[model samples]
Target: MQIEVLNSQASDINTIFQFYDMAVEHQKKVFNKHWQGFSKALIETEIAEHRQYKILVDDKVACIFAVTFNDKLIWGDRDKDSVYIHRIVTHPNYRGYSFVKEIIKWGKLFAPMNGIKFIRMDTWADNDKLLEYYTSCGFSFAGTVTMEQTEGLPKHYEGISLNLFEIEVNEVAASM
Candidate 1:
């Protein structure tokens, strides 16, 4: 298996968007249908920072993930060198291999070199399967997001609360 960390660019962005769409369709059992596009501004903001775009490949694209501190509202803010994982998605065809787990492990190991010592991520509360998967992958449930759904997003109105998870890279590594 080949795991690579990529950056957001015209070619890779298109590929990542397509991968996300496919993953949502394939994992509809967990992903909400309303998962929408990140505003152009949001994408650009991250792009301007040149945030690390993490990808896992096993002959083909298996997963896509990006870690940055700005994903703070859902994931939280940590001190300098801290990071939050965003958009971690696994291709439908490679779901059984536990690709997301590998993505998380890769992030933990790669973070320190990038000045990131902690990593955080979030998921919907209803997605028990993913929650367990992250926990099994060494993430501990930090808290639940109880805020009222935002006006624009259908998920908040759909009555699904999100569960937040966090993992300290050193802690995760130590346990391993």
Candidate 2:
């Protein structure tokens, strides 16, 4: 019932990694290419930086994600007023809960409080199902871009076209 930043507790490390493995396993079954998974230290850094987050349902982490203020590698310094969403992984037992739609709704209320104008995210350009799903969830597809630089990006993003999605704050407010 709540979305909050994950704290850097040692116990959290195992749970997060477990979730990542579950996601990777699912991805392997469903997609030709998938996330290469992140290192525990990378997650530790996100936790320490307050970028990692979880959606708690009944006091348990049902879904997890990370957000960043800037993603110049994938986004190319396009929008300063954006919160870039990343690494959205759902707990296997929590599937079918529509957690992404929940995150989308939460972003509407949460983004503006921090002076953000856009709720932005990107996925592999080839992930058609995801593109359709995100579109159905209220994101506008902003076309795809092949990253020009990839050194600082995650492994999956090193040399691929990425589909961009964004929900402008004004648009959400207008609809509501």
What's the TM-score of every candidate structure?
0.75, 0.90
lDDT of 2 at 26: 93
Candidate 2 per-residue lDDT, tens place, 70-136, comes to 9877777586888888888898888888888888777777787788898899998999999999999
lDDT by candidate, in order shown = 0.65, 0.82
CA error at residue 146 for candidate 2, angstroms: 0.8
**Which pairs clash inside model 2?**
none
Clashes of each: 0, 0
Per-residue lDDT tens digits for candidate 1, residues 1-176, read 66665666644666677876776666666465446555555555566677636455744666776666644445434434667776777776666777667666666776776767667777778788779988988788987875454543324324556787777777547345
Tell me, by lDDT, which candidate is best: 2
